[model samples]
Target: MPFVADALTATYKGIPPSFQWPVKFCFYNSLIAFVLGAATGNVSQVDRVWTFLPTIYAAYYALLPLWPSKSPLPLYPFVPETAHPDVIRNYSPRALLMFGLIFVWMCRLTFNTWRRGLFNLKDEDYRWEILRGKMPPWLFQMFNLVFIAFMQNVILFVIAVPVQIAAMQQPTGLGTSDCVLAVLALLDVAMEFVADNQQYAFQTFKHTGKKDEWPGAHIAWTKTDLKRGFITRGLWAWSRHPNFFCEQTFWVLINFFPLVAPEYPGYAPPLPLGAGTSLESLFPIIPGLVICSLFFSSTKFTESITAAKYPEYKSYQQRVSMFVPFLTPVWGLYLTLLGKKAEVDMVVYGQDVALDEKKKA
Candidate 1:
């Protein structure tokens, strides 16, 4: 294991310093997480770095323009005179945009997690506890090392790779596609904000039993209030995990910046950069793909637990969409474009759940 870790470390160091430092930062953080998790049985060590690391990466990229080229710092190594003689070293507009957006996101996520008591480590994610219960101790330990500490940290860094890659290339200026990508990122953020607020409101209402007393989204689940179960309101009415969907979409949009950049050699979404001809260039897409896959698997596990807890979840799943909210509207449009009549399944519930007519009707 030490040999493998050494080999990985050496490989990381071989890259330019811009990539080298962030990769090493992620590696050390994950290693610390593994040690903490193994010793203390708290697998959420990775969670602590989740929101902050991306901001660091984004800030690294955003501040590239400020670093003097002739300086002895590691930032100078990113613009190897021989390799990137023509590369612009100015601060990237796209990167500045990305940095600002990520800062906002990091604050929101950190606040949300902190509010749930994650900052002091007083509370670990429920998913970790549930997995610990299901797996034997030894197996769970292995899972902790491989998945929680290693894989998750790696994935988190990968999702932020675009910011690093963009800074490395240092595209001349923001274009149409860059603006579009920025807007898309913010729109996803907005969606996630709405979804999270809805879920938070529902949970508060449920736990406090102050549905009518509270000044938020009304939770008039009289029939299921006695049962005490999942929420089916606001963004939840359209999709089971709207927040997860938005989260995935935002990262995927991050990957698009490279595609739209004027300096990118490739024509596709996952434009490779190192040497342009090697398979390593394709590595940029790994973060987005991995995140999408992770969310899919995560949703399945979360839904199972939720289903066992709530009797009506199955019916909700049968009626409303899962990842895509109000998929019927999109599907209906697709069918209409093909000159075929399609009836959207806009009805989610008969009486117990009431959906806003603006959703489809």
Candidate 2:
């Protein structure tokens, strides 16, 4: 692992400045995980599939030498030793609710990623291709292995620890709030899945067209004479990037579940005696909220990049909401604050709004 770490460092040194921050963030998170493992003398290879480091670290901490040496209760149905007796004894129902929500989130996201050919060894994301153009193969591979592959996965997993902690420490009982959260999570996953599928189908259709044939069968390709590659139908029509909106919504909903217990009506059933108070009572909601905020900021950055890429994007932005569909009135405030000028029948894809150049010319 030391040799692997050293190799990763060297590879990171060669990357362009723009990609370095996210890559370094991953490395830094992994380093912290390693240090924590070393300090607890529990250093051992954990399966890469369960890469969320916070839950792993929490479980590790729960089973540390300082605590009564026994397995923690399972946080998810699949994860072993996730919830120990000590944890369960102090469990908060609200936390467990969040845990369940996150489990669903992880499964959906992991499944989507797998289906998108992301799990295939032969293919990688296009963003990686862009990075490769600016760096050596070996160095890029090492950087990807450590930062993109290992560390990023670990950080996401670890950041989700609050769900596990909430489950372990919170009491358990069904409630209207839980039902509401479940519904929201389901909707979030569904929207993201649909958006991803649509985008995938559009790209595939574009690639398989005959040499002389016009691009069709996808909304983004409708104006075939125009060479705009932007997606603009289905959920994309509602929000230029619906998948991003759904992804952010999913995480926020997961984080919000713990807070719901306190807000739930008194008619909601209480947990068994000794199960403790609400999950938020045990662990503050602020950290998870802050993490959700960061995720939203990241989504904004992605949207900005997308807008810059597609000439038609600004016009689409004027007509559509960014994060919320059918919430045009709310987004109007944002446009006003930015002092954006609106133009009717603005063509987005073919040429710069300022220029009337034709494709051939």
Q: Which residue pairs does candidate 1 place in steric collision?
A: none
- lDDT of model 2 at position 62: 30
Best by TM-score: 1
Q: Which ten-residue region of model 1 has the weakest summed lDDT?
A: 341-350
Report the Cα RMSD per candidate: 5.7, 12.0
Error of 2 at 17 (Å): 38
Give per-residue CA lDDT, model 2, range 204-234, as digits (tens): 5556642222222234344432355665555
- CA deviation > 4 Å runs, candidate 2: 1-97, 128-154, 209-221, 224-226, 263-283, 286-297, 300-309, 326-361
lDDT of each: 0.69, 0.52
The true-versus-predicted C-alpha distance at residue 253 of model 1, in Å, is 1.2
Model 1 spans > 4 angstroms off = 1-9, 65-89, 211-228, 266-278, 328-361
Residue 152 deviation, candidate 2, in Å?
A: 3.1
Question: How many steric clashes does model 2 contain?
Answer: 23
